[model samples]
Target chain A: MHPLDEALQMQQQDPGLYTAATHPGYANAVGPFGGITAAQLLQAALLHPQRLGEPISQTVHFAAPVNEGEFVINAQPVRTNRSTQHWLIQASQDGHMVAMATAVFAKRRDTWSGVDATFPHNLPDPQSVAPMQWQKRPEFTNRYDLRYFDGVIPHELSGQERPHGQSSLWVRDEPPRPLDFAALASICDVFFPRIMIRRQRWVMIGTITLTSYFHADSALLTQVGSDYVLGVARAQVYRDGYFDQSAEVWSAKGDLLATTHQMVYFKD
Target chain B: MHPLDEALQMQQQDPGLYTAATHPGYANAVGPFGGITAAQLLQAALLHPQRLGEPISQTVHFAAPVNEGEFVINAQPVRTNRSTQHWLIQASQDGHMVAMATAVFAKRRDTWSGVDATFPHNLPDPQSVAPMQWQKRPEFTNRYDLRYFDGVIPHELSGQERPHGQSSLWVRDEPPRPLDFAALASICDVFFPRIMIRRQRWVMIGTITLTSYFHADSALLTQVGSDYVLGVARAQVYRDGYFDQSAEVWSAKGDLLATTHQMVYFKD
Candidate 1:
């Protein structure tokens, strides 16, 4: 069975209040390093909003240490205001709040507007580049349906290690569903645990903290025009085995859709 | 004349496209030590929306290079959708984008629906703590209407060292305005810069980056409470006197109004 299927099976009782996935990497045998990847848990949370799968804004707090193990994720809608909706997701290990998140999603609308700056008219369209076909083991793959528009990985990640910056790839909903702004709010932190250290690979030490702010249209499944600016991502500081970075995920052309910031534990 | 007047005076005739701000200190600043101080400029940005009197969600980028000088700020309202309004503020020096911000704001409403569980509780009442009185300063004195609710400065900027965790203050719109959401978005980067110092006394290093998100709500200025929860904030990582940190600012009633993550320069 697929790992996601197994995880779903464990949750067959369907305690829709939370996810019943047993992520392997976060098992106790691995110590703190074993904690379920934030990405895995975040994916589960984002999937919860598949019904209204529009992207929103999310802020996460690392309340305590998380060790790899069988974990449960609890998520539910908090407040549905006039223009925005808020959801709270908590990931627990052995009944402790390891990581917690708050997501704010905006409602759908037909129109949006912003400044029309000169987009790097020079940069090639993400489509013009060769498709990035990176396959993840079933354990990690179930979490994301990632598509790479910028075909080339940054040189720093290219085995050629240097204090260089990073790049952007087009990402979207997996299993294809319409999601709202709230969903986007949660995934913005998906890349931070892996920022910098491109040439060298490091299993996510863990997400010390992940947070994001959502802007633009809430409908991610549709509403294309690149009203958002080109995605500009970079790692500002990575030292002493810890890194802090931020990324601007632009709309297709060059409107600013969302901005994300993260601090990751680089256990090198 | 107000320091703000000193700052915004000349009103350079340039159409005003945002540009990046540069500073002196770094892993490699020719001068033994120099850096950017972002909180002040950030506070300045908060006043803009209030100036225009618009309510908006806030998304700020700490741009690649740290901003070092007195730059200009231009807030362009992107789309005033029926129910929502969006704007992008660009901070620039000569003609480069120093930092850009995109924010969303909603029309104020008196009531909304929320899960009872989401109702903020378990927070101290604002009346419980004595309002902190700040000694006047020639520069920042009246510029900001700062009311220290939870943690009091007790003393002037004598540069004394104390605790290490996050600090909280009650920040509201000055000059008697309706403390709009955009105003809070501006100051979100305010208190976070000083969390790094083992001692309170430190000089201006530049801020590498700042990313902020809007939270559920804090009581409007009228319902203002006491006891601010500095919430969870930390110097996630610091190297060569440069560090980045994230903070969640909560109101006395436990309402998480706004959260901020900033990369500021700190030195011994």
Candidate 2:
């Protein structure tokens, strides 16, 4: 099995309850990669027997970091409408809350459609861009292939103005797994902290909350199967002790796959 | 007292519980304005004695339409760190979930800061723009003084290609209320549905999930007190009965006050 799929694997204990363990391959400095945790939490909802349709929006709040080993997920369908459903999911370790999330799923119908936000232009093909080579990389970083167009990691704290904190990159699973909602959810958080790009120095930082809006349907994902997707992320403003990051993920063919935003806590 | 304040008023029942009524002044077709509900949900956290600081991010899901009259809000702080806190807020009517939200609050401190996203450029001052006049407006529309610079409502559904679904306007309370987090939260949703602007037609539409990242602090809000803030909203894509709207709220002085995004359900 692919590492991501293996890491996200779960056993259902009840209708909306499941148990899973953290994958050592995806370990970060803390518990596990936040994206993996996010994927696992969202997987609980996708696996629910009462799920109405594919997820269109999901928001996850990381209240506490997870520990190694087993954890429990409680996915509850708070409301189910004729064509839409809402879920409230929580992950806990030792009966203590570690993360919470809310998701929206719907049975989509044909509609008048168009894209108002344009895809990034003037970028080289993914195959031509050199892949990122990290020094002292985390286990999770090894799970994917990353190629940067801009905002590469600095060798040392520049201590100079690094204006326009933006990173655009092409990314795909290391073992080349087909694109899926779970994989897409995990990919949304792949960008390193914007602060690291902006200040060129590592600071104590963690994502407090992250929200992702998936635009691609099953057909779209299948079309992007086992291919690199372009991701662009930038920080709007860094104020006080919190900052917000806005990101867009696009398929190689220029289809917008997902848009995500998160609020991070930092201590300088 | 301001109608917005009156509409968001609540009576505390417990440490994490409060009761509030929907204000008719802000009623839409089926329920009170979603922005008001979002503000009330955030207010629940703001009012909690245990809350550590101001909110930096909030996500609210409209599980069901809230009816007129009283609703119960449960705002519990699931986790609290030294400088950051996480909250789970839910609004219910008759023991059924009507809305669910999560919030992150932090005690902001002075930090290295800058804005990467540019504010909209080249527009007449609010005083020069004519206020929007509605022939048949919702009650909530009357609560604001809106002056549009672009993407005004078309006299009729053109049925032609309405490209670039965007709206830029200057808006504030009709009677002019001072800017605050609650009022700012309400302002985030002031833009008429993007579909109405895109397709140039009235469609069956409702927001399923809305997320707002507050960028300005109390000090900044005070500086822009009662002034018309510029709001620019645009749709990224509309697909399969669902679409996403992205918006940025700016102070008259070009300060980005907040950025908001929402997924709306639409029927063609």
Candidate 3:
């Protein structure tokens, strides 16, 4: 199994109870990368027997630092409607909660479809853009092939003031894995905190909460294959040591695949 | 007290257990307004003794239709850090969950603060604009003083094929209450569904998941007082009978008060 798959793999200890081992490959400054934990929480819902369909929306709260070891995830289908299902998933280590999330899934049907927001234009091909050099950064950064299109890359920010906290880039799984909902969830957090980009300073920061809206279906994700997807993220406001970042993930053909928003807590 | 306040008012029967009455003025087509429910859920957290600071982020899942009448709310402080707290709140009728929500609160500290996203430019003042006619809409609409700057008002779609799902308006509480977190939470859902604006068809639509990030603190909110705040909402994509809407609430002075995103289930 791919390392990410292995990290996300869960054993069904009992119905609605699963256990997962933390993988060191995706380690951040703290515990495991938040992205992987998010994907794992969503995975629990996806693996549920009562799951209705694909995930429509998910919000994950990083309540505490997850320790590196075996963790238990309990996913409960809180409510199941004819067309949609709501799930509550929590990750606990040593009998203490570390993360909690809620997911909404629905069996989508054909309907009037359109993209209102235009895909960002004029981006260099992923092949032409060079991958970010990661030597002393978080181990998780090595798991993704990232090509920056604009904005200050992490660790490269000098005390420069940027007009806005915006970053556009092309990113995909480093080992070139096929695109899927789990991978998409991970990609949403790939954008380094907007504060790090804007102030050109790498401060202690963590995402307090994240919400992702999946706009692509399985077919669309499959069609994209292992190609890179363009991502654009910008901060609306940075105040009181917290900022809100909004992002969009688009297919190579400019199809909007997902949009995510999060609030980050930073120590200045 | 205003009907909204009455509707949201909860009596603490016991620690973490509260009882609330549903006010008819906030009724939607089927149940109490989702916004009101969201506010009440947050209110529960606010009233919690262990609650810290203000709400930084909140996501509420409408699991089932909330029937009118008395309801019970249970709020729990899931995790509390030195500066931040995580809460899980649920609303039930007769012991069955109707809505579930997670909220993050933090004692904000002064830091480098700025608004990256400019307040939308060239908008008419709220006074110059006329309030939307709500004679035949949801009873909740009557609670807001709304002035549309663009997009087709709900129920007034004239079958025009607009390029995108976008709406810009100035809104305030109907009784002209001072801005607060709960009131701001309610205002976040004031915009009609983007599909209704883009296709000019009033389809059966409901918000399944809604997440709001508060950018302004109580001081800023109080400073804005009862003045109208500009709201802009747009959809990135609408497909498979579901669409996602992103919106921003900005003070007339251009301070971004809140940003919200939601996934809505709709019938074409």
Candidate 4:
């Protein structure tokens, strides 16, 4: 199994009880990459027998740092309607909750389709851009291949302050695995916090809450395969020690896959 | 008390348990207005004795239609950290769960602050713009004082079809009450579904999931008083009968107060 697959793997102890071991390959500064945990939480729901459909929207709240070890996850399908299902999932270690999430799933049907946001233009192809190399960064950073089209990389700060927080990049799995919902969820967090890019310095930052809306289905994701996807992220406001970031994930063929928003806690 | 206040008012039945009555003043096509329900869910969390600081992010899932009558809300502070708190709130009518929500609160400290989005300019003052009058629309329409700056209002659609889903308007409580978290949460849903505006047709539409990030504190809200706030909303994509809408609420002085996103279910 791929390291990511192994990292997100869970053993079903009971119908609603799951046990997952933390993997070092996806480790962040404090714990496992939040994106992996998010995917695990969604995985629990997807594996449930009563799961209704594909995920339409999901919100994950990081209550406490997830320490390395075996953790328990409990997912409950709170409500299942004719066309939709609501789920509440939580992960805990030693009886203390570390993360919680809420997800909504629905069986989609064909209808009028349109895209309002314009596809970004004039960007170097993924093949032309060289992948960033950072040996001492978080272990999680090593799991993805990131090629920046704009914004400064963390260690190479120019000391030139920026007036805005924005970054555009091409990203994909390091091992080039086929794209899926779990991988897409993890990619949503691939962009380093926008503050790091704008201030030209690395600071202590953590995502407090994240919400993502899926715009594509399995067929689209399968078509994306192992190719790099364009990612664009920017911060709308930074105030009272918390900043909100909004991001978009687009396919190489110009398909909008997902859009995510989160509020992050930062310290100077 | 204004009708809005009455519509959102909840009676404490016990610790973590509250009862709220549905009022016709906020009635939708099939149930109470979703905005009112969102406000009530936040109210339950705010009233919790174990609650922490201000709300930073909230996501509410409308699993089932909230029937008109009395409903019970159970709010639980699932995890409480030193600086942040996570909450799970659910509403049930009889024995069926109608809605579920998750919220994150934190004790904020002063930090570097900046607004990336510009305050919308070149719009007429709220007073100069006439309120939209729709006698046959959902009863909830009367609860807000909306002055359109662009886009065709339902029932008065122009023959011209819009290629994009976008709406800009000024909104205030019908009775002009000072803003608070609950009131602000409700105002985020004031914009009609973007699909209706883009297609220039009133189709069956409902919000499946809504998430909002609060950018303002109570002190700022108080300073703004009862003045109208500008609201700009647009759809990113409409596919498979579902479209995602994103919006921003800005004060008269151009401060971004909150940003909201929602996925809606639409029929042709």
Consecutive 10-residue window with the lowest summed lDDT within model 3 chain A:
A152-161
Ranking of models by TM-score? 3, 4, 2, 1
Clashing pairs for predicted structure model 2, backbone only = none
For candidate 4, the docking band is high
* Residue-level lDDT tens digits of model 2 in B115-234: 887887897988999888654678998899999889988555565657778999999997899999999998988898888887777788999999999989899999999999999999
| Candidates in order: C-alpha RMSD to true structure | 21.4, 1.5, 1.3, 1.4
Chain A of candidate 3 gets a TM-score of: 0.97
Once model 4 is optimally superposed onto the true structure by TM-score, how far is the C-alpha of residue A54 displaced, in angstroms? 0.8
Model 2 - which docking category? high
Which model scores highest in lDDT? 2
Off by over 4 Å in 3: B154-156
Candidate 4 chain A has its poorest 10 consecutive residues by lDDT at A152-161
Model 4 per-residue lDDT tens digits across residues A1-268: 7878988789998765799878899999999888888888888888888888798888998888899999999988999888888889999999999999998889998887888887899979888887775435899888899998787465566656688789899999888889988888888878888887778777689998888889999899999999999999999888888889999999989999999999999996
Residue B246, model 4, lDDT: 93
True contacts kept of each: 0.00, 0.89, 0.95, 0.85
Best by DockQ, which number?
A: 3
Give the TM-score (vs. native) of candidate 2. 0.97
Q: Write the per-residue lDDT of candidate 1 for residues A154-221, one digit (tens) a residue.
A: 32344554344465565543343333343344346444233433433334454445656554553332
Provide the clashing-pair count of each candidate structure. 53, 0, 0, 0
Please give, for residues A161-180, the per-residue lDDT of candidate 3 as tens digits.
77888988899997999998
